[model samples]
Target: MEAHTDIQTTQKGFRCTLCDVNLPNEPTVDAHVKGRKHQNLFRLRETRKRQVQNSVFVSGIKPNTLSTQLIEYFEQFGPVQDVIMDKEKGSYAIVEFEEQASTAAALHRTEHVMNGLKLRIKPRESKEFKVVLKKKQDGKNSQVNLDALSQELCRAASVNEQMLRVVESFQLNENERNGRELLVKLLQEVFMEFLPDCEIVPFGSTVNTFGVHSCDMDLFLDLEKTRTFQARSKTASEPTGEGQSEDGRSEDSILSDIDLTTATPAEVLELVAAVLRKCVPGVHKVQALPTARLPVVKFSHRNLNLHGDISIKNRLALRNTRFLQLCSELDSRLRPLVFTVRFWAKQKQLAGNPFGGGPLLNNYALTLMVMFFLQNRDPPVLPSVDQLKNMACEEEECVIEGWDCTFPSQPIAVPPSKNTEDLCTLLAAFFSFYATFDFSASVLRDKSFQRECADAEKYCRSLQYQRKSSKGKSWGLVRLFAPSCPTGAGAGGRQGQGEGKERHLELSLPFRLAALPDAVQRRLGTAGERFREQWFAMVRLAVETVFQEVLGCSPAQEEEFEGQMDTSTSSDAVAMDTAKEPEEVGGHDQTEGVAAPSGSSGGVVSPQAGQKRPFASAETSPVSPQEKRQKLCAAEDEEEDEGAEPAPSASWCWLQRHPVWAGRRKVRRDLLKARGVTGGGSAEASQPDGGGVEMELQVTRHITAKEPDPHDLVAFKVGAQVVGGSENTRAVLRFTPLCDQKGHFQDFFHFLEIFLPKTTEAFLGK
Candidate 1:
């Protein structure tokens, strides 16, 4: 048989790492894993590798040679630094140098022929690159004063309303983006460094219908070839990238024909930001987080700041994203519903910012849950995205990408009924559905919800409402569209752990949004209700924060997860979507910790989290590169000459990674009232009131393995049982690892911290 890939002999039974042959009682199998035959082979491979450092693969070397022989051979260019030798693999190791330039020189100078073996030398990809960029850019960027700008905005907020409006208009309106076309061209030139000939398309409020002044530029960086979007148009003389007609007529094309396959997504986004910063004077702050809301950057130009996300999505992901975006667009009811709820929640100080959350809720998450709730209703509140696509006005697809291309179609019948009463009814419906809905069974089989909804519809039909909409559609207070998965989309394909197969994951009926286990759930439920009870504003904050914390608010990550959620944190993190791990690219650790709150501090944009203000810091690496070690005598003299400052401990940085977040109802009185006295408004409200529901959540350990498993990201499963329900109502969910560390009580606390306050306010309506 061929050599076993993963055969290892541990203290327990015979363990075969690769070929799964459990020879529990066979001593031969055990010995086969750890014997002189394997040991000698391992040493021989290791010895050969040690002959030349930084080699990708080194094997079959004489074991008798010492380190001095390897050092002498490489010393020809200059003095060498530390050498890493893999004793067992005998395959490869890394070598560091005092100077990066010197290291670069060495990589070029030494390719092969070191210590009787060809060697491989190249710069190792590591976090060290961050340090070099950080140090060099730090000084130059200091000139841009972010604090002054923040102070100016804050002062403006206090007095000058017009200034804020002007600033807001620049951010929210499409007209502000007029002078930005030239800027966009510059950006395209830079992005082409990676995508070569791909196009950058801007959508959302930036294009107009209902835009605000402060809205971030929502752009879709399309890296696909030009042939993809080319569709026939109505006009004959218009220039198009579309195919030539058989009748010798020019076909319509959405954009110019282009080729785009030479570069990766990362390279594309980086180049665009780099080029924009160089060409645009007011544009700066280029952050490239591929795994963020969208793999792009957020920067400002000419007093206007915008964040752009790149979508190099496959046809399926693209279709899904576009479908969802269209659903929000088709119904003026959809975007406004979500945006209003989000904004209200923020204003009330119940949740964090829509874009940034401390332990904040994501607007998308709440919208999704709402969508699921409405879909499960009888007759379904709205159509799925695919169904909507088929029903959209032809003008929805009307493209006008040429210079000065703008929509000229007649406005359709969309209403303007944004009021608090409608919001309250929708929320009431939301709670009722969760309290009564069952999601474990087949969705199509759940007829009770639809039946009740039908009854409600009949009741509404008998009653009188002013005007009618498309077909006088039987309206549910809260409308939703749960698009059925396409047979072609292959929803039944190999399922991931966190990913749902049939429909996007749905909550079972027993899951009371307000119900927490009496021992644990009651306290949480009460706190959440209490927060809701207070200034209704507080409840809004909780909604935004929790949605993001429990679900997800990240646009880019959401798009990624819409495809697959890999929950594995092992040596293979960069490998594939087989597993997902806790996110910790920056010093910020995703270890389950206290979720941040919703307020000015909490509601701020996330990419700007940990950062105090915008335009404050330059884009650079986080750490500094190591310096060359001096000779022993010189090092001793230097040390003797000056005492050094102690290095910051890991614990300090660890604590700094997570910030405290809370529901407004939890500690409003402490924040707004002096001397810890309860104010007015509502007693159930944690803010105005000095008292809170004194209860503790008892979290049980549900870890399956006693020993550590490197591949698993889930620490445990949390189950909540309602105390007073007629029938025992229970809720259970699997928790993914947000960090590698084991002892993470913070996530639980973050949940309860914001949840309890809001739950309390909800029940009491304080």
Candidate 2:
């Protein structure tokens, strides 16, 4: 009678109609619902549910006899359960156990078998179970399972053991095909030890289809679980955990700008990075790059032979991540083509010099070439980053996790192995198609883009940076540099160690506390030593995120897509708007502004007038329907191909068309010459022997709307001309300064995401 009563109570508490142990408030009995134990339980529940939903399941077989079987030997672990094998049409079964514990045991122990053959054992499942496991999805209406994803990829690769460890027996070496990825993964594992939840993702040619002999890793760092951890910790500390969350929601500045209670993703990432860098090793060059459209940091440890950047953002980071991720996917197929084209380029000696010439081939030049190659294909095997985002699933509609780590992918459908197509035709198609791809809309339609135009408008208002003491104009320069972007102008060669190009390479190195002036460096070194905990924490996160998630497509689409085709891009440029500021090419831009007076909607300018209009809605507007259809053209041209044009002979060459960057070359020249400089020539100062020259350089502190300065002259300040141009004395650093026409350049490497590279003085700060 007592046993019966216990069984009845268990049934009541177990919440399962078939269970009988309803022990009340007994932590021991309910311990399964807490800690990793609980997570393990949920995992089992989901696995079982998937099997049931897929119409396949486990069944009868005694313990000892069934260990080798799949989906059948589950009955050995507990009380006997009803095993109904329905071999009718579907490949499944239903095993209802007498106790809940037995079912859990079955899930943990089940072995499968079919037709005198052993299959992989999984637990019983049901439609209801799937619904339960999909709470995050049902709560919003999207289905993205990251774990199953990892499993699927593992199964696909057939890498039975845990993590992928390349066998040492083979003659191993970093090759164009896999060096960067292999390095990124090694870095990821090291950083992961420090940042359990942060992510490291690689994008661009390093992972793209068109990658060649020498390529750079386009990385992004991400943190999504940090917020949940913070919230939970707070809840655990406070009695009114739930109440405080709801009440504190309004305290967030973004609460006013957006309905979302979450504060800035940038801020959260900052905190998380600070927490992880403390535990990571060999992360010496760690530094922040907050101004990057995605707040980021770049670093390298020669000891480990790893160098990369980290974009610190929210879970939604996948949007931009997927952008590049998709591009990388496209590259997988485009790579063979890249190799072919590059071989042709080398044979033709068209790889431009590293100091900015077309004959010198850079990774960017190669990507452009490949883009042209595919656009010319019969069916265009790869879509532009803009177009591919359209096919990605929306964030609210899907939740992706562990996207940045590594995973096996589906093979792309390429032309027949021997399908020979001329490079010229492929080249033509790329130029025509990309030049006209509709960007403004394609970007917003990203699977995870939360199209809160109003909220974005508000956030734009709050972007204030620290102001400089110098009152001169401050220009906002935005640029993205990766091997994939145009690196050098001539044939694909670069100056080495002691050549003048060394200066540019120096400019490219990440920061070192010791590199600063004695005073500044001392302070930083002390700060690093004292705050070593926080410093390491931040560095570890920055490194982890760059390799974990920044380069990965979100699981909802990316993981699944990888199973098919990857399509991530290096960066997403949904340009922001900015207010007018003074014009000065060399002016120091201010990053500060008064908080706009409080109003209903939030913005950077704080709706100075009425929270209605902060600045003209410079938000990138969508294109027309007709144009959209034209964009969908099967044989469209490559809209933004940097190739297909002759290299300009002069810095002011564009003046024949627009003369945008041809600043006051004469006046600037006079200013420098008056100061004892030799050809300090700013046309603005010199009345052109032929005519007057004037070009307004828009300068502002906020980077949101900064227009690009004209291109810099390729000539050395001393103008050795043809003299000293040999290997002994050429330009040291040949990389184009990371700036853009719309003040847009995606430098995968940047200092604090802005300012000058301490190692390189091309920017004002140096």
Candidate 3:
């Protein structure tokens, strides 16, 4: 078979480097090579190559000279196709001709004149064509330079000064702010030309006082005046039966095509996207997300290296941005405290999903949480939202989308907060306050988040958190921002003195009955008094499936246990069982156990380990869903006496040979695209949490097939139990690695920390 440079063979398939896509076989590869999209991109690349070859870079042109003028002067040599001017400085322009000879002709000329000014013409610079991957503006890389940032923060004299350093390091600089402002002005001008009286208002993080570098620019397209203009134009045109008025001004064709007031949000967003794609210079990757919670037109500005979103009806967001600005103005300490807390949350992985949608908390939620904590302070460091509304005068009143968004337009109209706490103290207090907060009754109820707050609270009390390290070690805010480690594991590896010290990784999947589909919820409700046990059994099956089927871990041997086993008392698992209706009582009661294998090693447990029994076999005869549910329920009821503690538990032992976690994301994305799943769709392939169960299974298969077989990485035991008192139910998995010669277990455990719960939810939700 002939070989192609662009097509490379992998363990599972062939990949097209040009299109960045994977093909499963020779036929598919052939089809992909002949695809329209691929062919178009190939032609486009060729065109760019020709442009670089036949174009000349011209300088010394007048600053005010337009591209059309340059094109006219360059046309004397040959036919001119396009002219690209440096809009920022206007010092240079690139003019491309239809023929290669045109470049030589232009270079042959002794002098070129544009508006009677001599121009410098030279061959255009050539560069390689490489795909630039699109990156979200989320602050996922805030820790990328942690070592450098820590070194700087460690030099601070105190925690208060350290926090000030954080604000300085993360906040947007003047140049960035100016660039955003220029982009906004340009957008305003372009939109006005098409839709007269339309206003593009900047809001969100860019205008909000808490903005960080690289945060997205959120714009609200206010079309109220434009709608009115269209209405007036329609009335005027009715009498004349023409699109133009007496003054010779004609309604823009784009605006005449649709009535903004009557159009659907999707239609309006499509129009906005069209304008952004066709009219805006330096803008690309324009997409209309009409199905989002807040319909928006997403775009990227290449010159600014910025991503932005434009929405048609987001007046409330504008008001919220103003509110945040007012809060920052009222208290100078608020900005530093918010910034520090947000960074801490990002480090702890309690907030900030790179792709936007996930279970993780967002910056806005974290900021609001800080404000809520401040409002509860002894002196009340900040006013409540309702209080702010009350403070607004009659003329200052504002309403949007039937929501009372009233707030003083200026800080002078409101009184300053009476709280006088320092930034360090307030930051520590913020963690302390949320540590014991009853999340079940509040909207921030996520067990993992509360556990993180409690951990941060403990760290805040340590001497290292309060003062700088004299020995140049990580301390104060620096230590607080470090990635959290598992129990018995220090910053890098096992902390204790014993070489054989056992390390455990724990994760909890809370029973969110409300989040389940109605049919599933009704089925659980039908289970009545046994609902918790049934749900726990189902979760046990899902965990087994994830380990053996999805993650490609082999089943070793199932061990039968009669009593509750000792579990870790680490702070990470402190409140693992707590929830709203039925609160966790801080313990587990074991009933049964199942052993499963993990990794490529395919190792087996020793016969002397224990008696073996399978609760739900991952590899066996396929059973009907109803039969499987019945078997799980029957297993829970087996050997159970009346009035006994009803905790249905299972355990699994597995061997993992391959690092399935490595490159799992890329594999999953490729699999999703191969399956014709892209964008934000309802399918599991579009999910940020490792996609759906089947998709994840495919991803694991692809990864393991490609990954080299190494020695047994780690053999671990998984203990699953259902815990929660009356209302809240949760499934807790406890991981205990039998061996850790190379410390690969920690990495595996960390991946599971997020992957397990999310994938389990995906399974249960299905």
Candidate 4:
């Protein structure tokens, strides 16, 4: 077999570097090498190479000189292939010849003339050939600017002023808005040539008055007039079998390819995509997403560095955009409040999923949430949507898609809000309002978002959030905008300090019986009112299995509490308590075990009655891992004790002897390969059964067997308790790292922050 520079042999397959794809076998590799995408990229690379070699950079050309005149002048030396002018500032252009010799000939002349004006000509600069990576439309540059913005906001006179500064820093500048307007006009002109009378209406963030820099330009392409024109042209030409309209325009244009009245949304979108790709200059990456909720043709303008979506069936979005604009105008406070909340949500990772569709909340949804909060304020900062519809005159009344969208066309038509709360107070109230919102009844039922709102509400009441800092530390809006850690987890003992201190790490595994399959739910229901206690015991066993058998950790001292202990103690105190009396590794001297009651299938013991048991060692335990997992499902049915305390907690110490958290993903892949499993696993592995647990255990074992043994990195104490009321039950685990002279505990703890919950869930689901 011949080797290609772009193709490299991997363990399981051959990888194509140019396309960033893997091919499984010789036949697939051969097919991929001959594929259209691979061939197109190869030709593009060669064309770019030729352009660098055969092009001449022309300067000092007259601004109004046409590309045709430049082409005529350049052809004197040799045939001119292309003339690319600087459209923004027509001071220079690049003229490409048919051959490199012609470029040399033109460069040697030193002077060129076009339309009686002398032009400076030089050989085009040589450059490396590299593929242009697709630009992510996430507005990441705007996020980068936020670091500078925080410094600027820190010097503000008050939190209200800092918020205004945030708006000033993020909103589109004059140049940016002008560029978008020009782009829209350019698009309008291009689409008019093919689909006559079509109008491109800008909507969403671009014109919603709450726009940020680099936001995507959402355009509603109104083709109703064009559809009428098409029908009229078809009728006019039907009698003569000719393709000319009454206005003498050619009816045999791109519109002739499809009947707008009869065409499917996907078909029309494809036509739009074709027009964008073929006719629009500087437009690339044109894609038609017909399957989207609102079918759209997504495109990017190369020169403008902007991404945009063109939708033909989104008239409702235009009305919604106008409503947002009117609301922003009615109350001056709305714009800054929306901007600050959006930024805070972005920082908290509760919103802004870059690729559009995900669990994260979008900007529009977040804006509406703010409006809803305002509408519910004590004095009512904003009117409800239905109320706004009533406020509009009869002449302005309108409906779209079976829903009323009428609103006052101008801000002057509506009365001012009576609520006179300052931006600071409104911002704080926005957080506090949503902290206790009933999201389950609405579409915004994301628990993580609710938790973040509660945290922000607490911060908003603090002095650090209400006032500026005198010690020049981050305070007010700056502190609020800082990226937050996961719910119960904190960074070391203090914020951002990881080394030379005791670290406190916590994770919450909610009782998600409702999220389980019906069969699993039925099995859990068999435990009756004592289900919570049994579930907690199952979680404890899962945690022990993950640390000992799966993660190669040795169990130390273990303690169980009958009721909730003080959770407000400092990390230093927790560390001192663990250090004061260290128990021997894998010791059962101080441990007591209470066997499961009456008819329990397995000999599973309850950790509740101040009873503890050592975790089963991988090499020494009589039971297999699968048996241990089965024991978790065999819970004892017990009657509920009405007078019992709601919370029972357990604490255990573990000494980690390996970096089990590191490189587990690669090892997992290798182990799956060894087992001949593809796509992670088959359908059974995806089930909530014990398949995932066994796979993860195998992954850890593979890593431990391959890597050299290291000295003890850290010893941490984990305390577990079932918290939350009836509606939101969860197992909360607080980790206190007692010994960390090597500083590896923080990394391990951060890994467990995500790992422990997921693995434990798999165990409990089994």
Q: Which prediction has the highest TM-score against the true structure?
A: 3
Arrange candidates by TM-score, highest first: which order? 3, 4, 1, 2
lDDT of 3 by residue, 450-492 (tens): 6667667777888888877778888888777876544322222
- Candidate 1 colliding pairs, count: 81
Q: Is candidate 2 or candidate 3 better by TM-score?
A: 3
Candidate models: Cα lDDT each: 0.36, 0.32, 0.72, 0.71
lDDT of 4 by residue, 1-766 (tens): 4567888999998998877788888877787887778888888878888998999889988767777788888898999988877755678889999999998888888556667798988878878666666657555775577678879988998999998998898899899999999988988998898889989999999999988878899999898999898999877744444777787777645788789999988998998887787557788889999855468999999877889999999888888888888898889888889889998888776788787655468888888899889999989999888888878999899899898888889877888888989999998898888888865334443456666676678778889888888999888888788765433321111242221132234566777786566775786688555556656766776777788877778665333221222234323324322322221111111211222322333323443466333222223322433422222222123343543333434555677877787766656655556778854267533432123677777777777776484666667767666555555666667666655644677678757755676677776665
Residue 409 of model 3: what lDDT?
82
- On a 0 to 100 scale, what is the lDDT of residue 391 in model 4? 87
lDDT of 2 by residue, 1-766 (tens): 1122112344445432222123454453444343354456567766675445333245343333322233345446554434444322324445555566766665664454554556454545444432232122241221133223233323322221111211111112356346555556765765444333446776654554333333334566543443453354345654444323433431222112222126664554454344234324444456666534346665654444555556654445444444434444644445433443443333223343433222144545655556554754565565543444344445323434654322222224222223243332332233334434432222111111111112222222321111211333220000000012122321112222222211222111222333335554454455522222222222222222221222110111111112221112212221111232311111222221222212211111221223232121213112212211111001112232332211100000000012212222343444445656543244433332212211112111112123244232111110000011111111111122212222222222121111222112121112
The residue-by-residue lDDT of candidate 1 on 189-300, one tens digit each, is 6555433345776654555333444556655666544333223222336544455533444432212222223445566556555445433345656566654434666666
The best candidate in terms of lDDT? 3
Against the hidden true structure, what lDDT does model 1 obtain?
0.36
lDDT of 3 at 374: 88
Q: What TM-score would you give candidate 3 relative to the actual structure?
A: 0.61
